[model samples]
Target: MKASIALQILPLSHSADRLQVIEKVIAYLQKQPVNQVVTPFETVLEGEWEELMLILKTAIELAGSEADNIFANVKINYGQILSIEEKIEKYHS
Candidate 1:
């Protein structure tokens, strides 16, 4: 894995069923190959850069198809850094 991406997807639907769209997106991401951590506001993914990018792109497309408007905020770190597990190990008992 050469990079990590923190992806935050916010889907706005014309109807009040926005949560359903968000949940569907999350479910799709969870099935991907990269290591993923789902937080309250964002999902952290660790893996090859290209693979991560694909996941991000697909996520946006999927959510946008289901919702009226979808916003994907991505934070990327290049080069090899500590794995997600390393960063949170201290907080996890």
Candidate 2:
């Protein structure tokens, strides 16, 4: 894969709205071509570099629209990275 990113979107909104915003972002992320691994606190995506960036941008903005503000924690690995499948294969049941 050309890139992989771990994106955590923290939306600063009331409890009622915060979860909906996060779910919205996750739903959008799931539909993309990128391989997505959604954990309790973050979503990891593996795909081509440009594709990943564009998806990340749209997801952040999607959450931002509903929340007062957002705090995003992103960890990016570009070039010669392990595919999401390779990384998690051993852990799968």
The candidate that achieves the highest lDDT relative to the unseen native structure: 2
Give the lDDT of residue 72 in candidate 1.
83
Total clashing residue pairs per candidate?
A: 0, 0
Q: List TM-scores for all candidates, in order.
A: 0.91, 0.91
What does candidate 2's lDDT look like per residue over 1-93, in tens digits? 499999999987664388888899999999998788999999999889999999989998888887878888999999999988898889996
- Show model 2 residue runs off by greater than 4 Å: none
- The parts of candidate 1 lying over 4 Å away from their true place are none
Candidate 1 lDDT by residue in tens digits, 1-93 = 488999888876676368888888899999999898999999998999899889989999888888878778899987977899999999999
Q: lDDT (CA) for every model shown?
A: 0.87, 0.90
Stretch of 10 with least lDDT, candidate 1: 9-18
Instruction: Tell me the deviation in Å of residue 73 in model 2.
Output: 0.8
